[model samples]
Target: MGRNIKRILIIGMSIISSLAVGIIRTEAAEATSSFGSASYEWMQGIESPIGVYVSSDTPIYYMEMIVTYDPEILQYSSGGELEEEGRIKVEIVGEESIEVSQMLYFVPLCSGTTDITIENVIVQYESGETAAVASTSAPITVPLEEGCALKSLLVNGKIIEGFQPDILSYTLDLAENIEKVEVTAVADSDTTTVEISDTSLVIGENRIWITTMNEEGKRAVYTLTVNRVQNLSGEGTTKEEKTRHQEVEVLREEKEEGGNDIQRIVFLILAGLFFILAVLLFLLIRISERKRRNRRRCRAKRIAYQKADLLKKVRENDRQKEVLNKTSEIEIDVQHVTMIFKREKDEATSIKELLIRTIKRQRSYELFKALDDVSFTVYKGEVVGIIGTNGSGKSTILKIISGVLVPTKGQVIVDKNKIQLLTLGTGFDFELTGRENVYLNGAIIGYTKEFIDEKYEEIVKFAELEGFMEEKVRNYSSGMVSRLGFAIATIRDTPEILILDEVLSVGDMFFQKKSSARIKEMMNGGSTVLIVSHSTSVIKSNCTKAVWIEKGRLRAFGTPEEVCEVYEKMNQE
Candidate 1:
């Protein structure tokens, strides 16, 4: 029984040992380590002076290094020599303090890499005599990243030379047989970024190949450059003796897996909510679009019916007016036409003063009795024309008649069933597309949305901007905008009194002739029309009678020929 137990124990121990060795090999395979270098200094003594760099011409005996390490290792050792351009004496003050006590001369190097090292570092010994460790520091690179090119190595203060390259690529000459070759690039400007490939360089003269590529697949070749640095006399330091100390920081792997599952569940829930929201939004948008389309269809039908009714009424009134009267008659009755404009206090003392100043001081505003005791009446179907110089209130009169502006003092009375004030092209929001502005202007013209929808295609065709209908009115040429505006105004089939405001100025000869014919058709259909123009040709060609307005007063009101003759004579005077 004892022998059997021993065999079992031996077998179990061998198995355990084999498994432990296998696990150790696996862990080692997965382990990784990286190497880098830092710089430390040696003090001359506990109170001795150190050297530093300053912009002054004065010599500096004390220095400082931007070093890393907590309570840095400071000590003196015998097995070290600083690889500098000059010789420097190093002394140990405390048991762990190291420093340079004597000044050293330095030789300057021009081109090529220099070997800089600190030797004679005294460390702990296991079983050998005079055991020491070598601490290597990177050679100082000058001119930063863009200035100098480093392409060589140094070890222990000597150039251990005779190096050749396997591949020779160059912006400059290179040595051969480089090892632990690490090539790095640093940039001064933020415009470009630099990337380094190799970080290990061997100690020796070497020939290296360097390649640079831009974002555009453009390649540039730079010669592996080696710059020589001779001024290594910054400070000489003795190595500090360190006690053989091993510290195992108790790092407990918490294996925090519970919170990971919770985070995954939260992410899944959020993802599901987003998906549901996206689906809901899509459905809502689709429904809204459908409703908008239905409303547009209904509006179009209503507008069509209203346009037909307006055209019928206009025809019936035109017939009634033409047959009832043959002689021209005029009656003016304006209860009171008052216009008020707001003014800032700084502008003028009072409203009356502000008005006078506007007329004289600012020449842009012309004061006029836009309509003074203005009240008028004309026999049925009488054609009237209004003429005035720029600021003499011709447009103001039309705007009042069209109900776009209200008089501050009086009431306007018309014998006609309805008024059609043809404003030509005005009051258009250029930000909206031509098609969109059509509906807006239609509504302003007393046509329902339904009517605009019914004639939408016809309006676009008349404007001849079929392809550009959707383009913003701001983008339209002046001619295109005028045509579109004219098309929208005239397309409204309405009323007894048709008022025309210098609308014939736009369009070519063909369009003018076409518009004239349309006017004649409306007139013959018995519509009472009021025509306003500075053009004698339009007045004579379209109006049976005319009214000339000069300086906010009626200059002439008679047949077109008689009125225009008076206008010519008045202007000549």
Candidate 2:
């Protein structure tokens, strides 16, 4: 019985020993094959940690591993061999087990769960053995955070709120004089940065853009619009400024009252002189009456003798009256004319001197002789052209004839209220509409409202502004305004004498041709026209007589061909 029991115990002990050896071998194999493992841990709102560790059972001479994650969620900061595009390559060179850890910068672009994966993992052993392993980390949860957004927007130091979050546009209205504006924006979080486009406002309208950005590469944009309206009251003066002006007016009235005292005393002295003249006139009338009575008695006696002579005198007077009626018609007769302009000398060269002179009201004038004893004559039904170079007093003579400038030394005798002068774009109000300006300009030139109303459509048609008549004159181009002004001045009313100053050179070729034809038609209707032009061809073609002035003196006065020939020769010389 003892021998049998011993045998069974020995077999049991052998089996136990073998089982322990196999278990040890299996554990050793597992430790050698498992070269490394990877894991990652991330907390909310904090940088994540990624780690790779190798087992001590196997030593690696060189190894490469790749770690990848959602780039929008986490960005690799450091601790890798080569890192790009959310993937990091790690290399380990050692004779023992090693641990590799990488710091991943987190950007919470959204509130979601994400994973950091270890992919394409490769490990090479010192004994020329290779291993591949792939793994993924636990889900990392990101908390919801407010992204880039504007908390407040301020314009001109005034906060703007109560706006729809989705609507990023706003508008502001200001006075026209407000030429500048300042803008500021506050972001929802300190992690967001804000930028503004333009803050300088213009006269009419201005647009400003504000951009906000967060650390997660998210963006928000807002826009602002400003409209500036013109202030036309007080002629652009403010209410406070008008109050100050009233104070100034009161002081001026007080000063004028002091000067009126002297005027009143001078008026009394003039009244005494008029009284003496009245007494002298009464004495002269009594003497004339006594002389007339003596002559009346002698006239009765001679009446019978003068009857036959009176009949002969009446017949002769009748004949002379008929003769005188044929030669008395006259158009423009500018006789012995002289013009002088007095202007202040330019003595101030600097701003300080100019301001001082203005404050002191000091003035010194220099006289310039524009025309010296100039004389010209125009008969009825004639087209006279005045030709000259620049600053030659040609326009000055015309101005005198047209009653624009009075001659200092001579007389201009023309039919009263029978003249019209056309100057380019003169007396135009640019702020008014084209249609309104037509009537406004017509009133200024002595045209009755009924006459303008009758001719309004005619004038618009002539100016070719049918479609744009309601548009503002300020918006019209220079040529368009010139055309409108010329059309109104020329076609609105017909005058006996028409004066033109460089009006033929206005507008395009077609309009010039049309204007020339109209002038010719007026001349054919027995209306006298005087023109000042630089084009020799225009003068030669349209003028029956030409007057040339040079350096404030008449150089020639004759037919257009004769005077222009001389003028052209002078230019060549």
Candidate 3:
């Protein structure tokens, strides 16, 4: 068993060694072929031959090669002139040749037949002269019949073809990208049949095997690979080629104008500009129309309001006349009425503190001059509306009249009329039930418990919260809350002078109409109404006279229409 194992191991080692030696020999043979072989070819009468013929299946249009010798026989380098060694003067008269009639003959010198030969081809080393001996003395003939035709797919200048043997085998350099390829022998129409493998190939380096085909199969195979390299010329191609391409482009665009990419890009840019312009124009027109509509609506509302104002003033005039007629016999005395709010000075306070404070003194409460040097008198049973933009002391005047905020400079004298501030749900608790709140609010508004109890059913019915009375007030919607508030405010018997601070604007249109009707009803009952509103239309419609406040000062005081006109014109500027 041991002898059998040893024999098998020896056989395996021998096989591996032999295979390695064969591979090395094959590689060496290929390397020798790549550099090519130089041998003398004996002719019948020719002498001193210098050039050799190299034939391939592909056509040899040109050849650029470096001839390297053993340095002893022919010591030569390319580019520079040949450096002759010993007594040998082997010169290449011309390295180029063209085939005429399937024969490569020498170029004629003057009028005589030129022999392809080298003169005095002698070899003289350091010792003496010795005639050079030929290593290969047979005629070296690479038949043109066996050469391959090398050509490019396109005749354009982009692809340049030449010989390249930078590998173990000779090949063609396609110095540009090949979109498609085909290899054929004897042309397409030739009867002298030749064969190749894989005629069509992709755009890359590919091997094209050339061989002769018999009736059975293939023979005499010479595998030659054609390398298609990627060569990019960034000069935007040649002018002639670019012009031809441009002509094709123009024709393409003419055929399919809508599909032209350049035209499409241009069309898209134009369309975007037009779209932006159209949108801007539409926006401008819309804004202009809105402004026009607002002006027309404002004017129409203002005119309607003016008519209502005139009617209110006429009614107020009639009431004043009736009051004067009733009290003609009673003598009313005029007395000097003055009002002021004083700010006390502190000895310890500095000037900076005085500048920062509303009141100049540290010891005194801050006194803001809300209604400084302001005075107004209302006749009996007269209705007035104070119209102003935001922050014009309109609410301050209402507050002063309601006694919620004492004025720094003002006096009020109501002979026999009771003043009441009409606000929306002034005193109501959110956490408590509506029923509990009714009792709490009634007491706060200076009403007795018995009076509230009598009005409880009417308030609940008017607010429309019959079953919701037991529920917490916070649970109600805004509209429902406002409804309850309006009911609570109007449940009272009418006061002599009503001080309303734009509370009717709290709810939606339905509630606003209801509240307006209640206010009109109060005015009809000979109650003096003093109202404040930013809405000039509301003031003009509901009040007998209007006062315009501007920048914390009285700008104008007249009939509602007249004051509102002045305010509107100033706002337009």
What's the true lDDT of residue 301 in model 2? Answer: 60
Model 1 regions lying over 4 Å from their true place:
1-368, 374-376, 404-411, 415-417
Ordered from best to worst lDDT, the candidate numbers read: 2, 3, 1
TM-score of 1: 0.37
Q: Total clashes, candidate 1?
A: 59
Q: Please, what's the RMSD in Å of model 1?
A: 39.0
Q: 462-503 in candidate 2: lDDT tens per residue?
A: 888889999999999888988898888887445789888888
Per-residue lDDT of 328 in model 1: 32
Model 2 TM-score? 0.42
Please list the C-alpha lDDT of all candidates, in the order they appear.
0.50, 0.69, 0.52
Residue lDDT tens for model 1, 115-140: 23333333211112222223333332
- The ten-residue window of minimal lDDT in model 2 covers 27-36
Whole-model lDDT for model 3 versus the true structure? 0.52
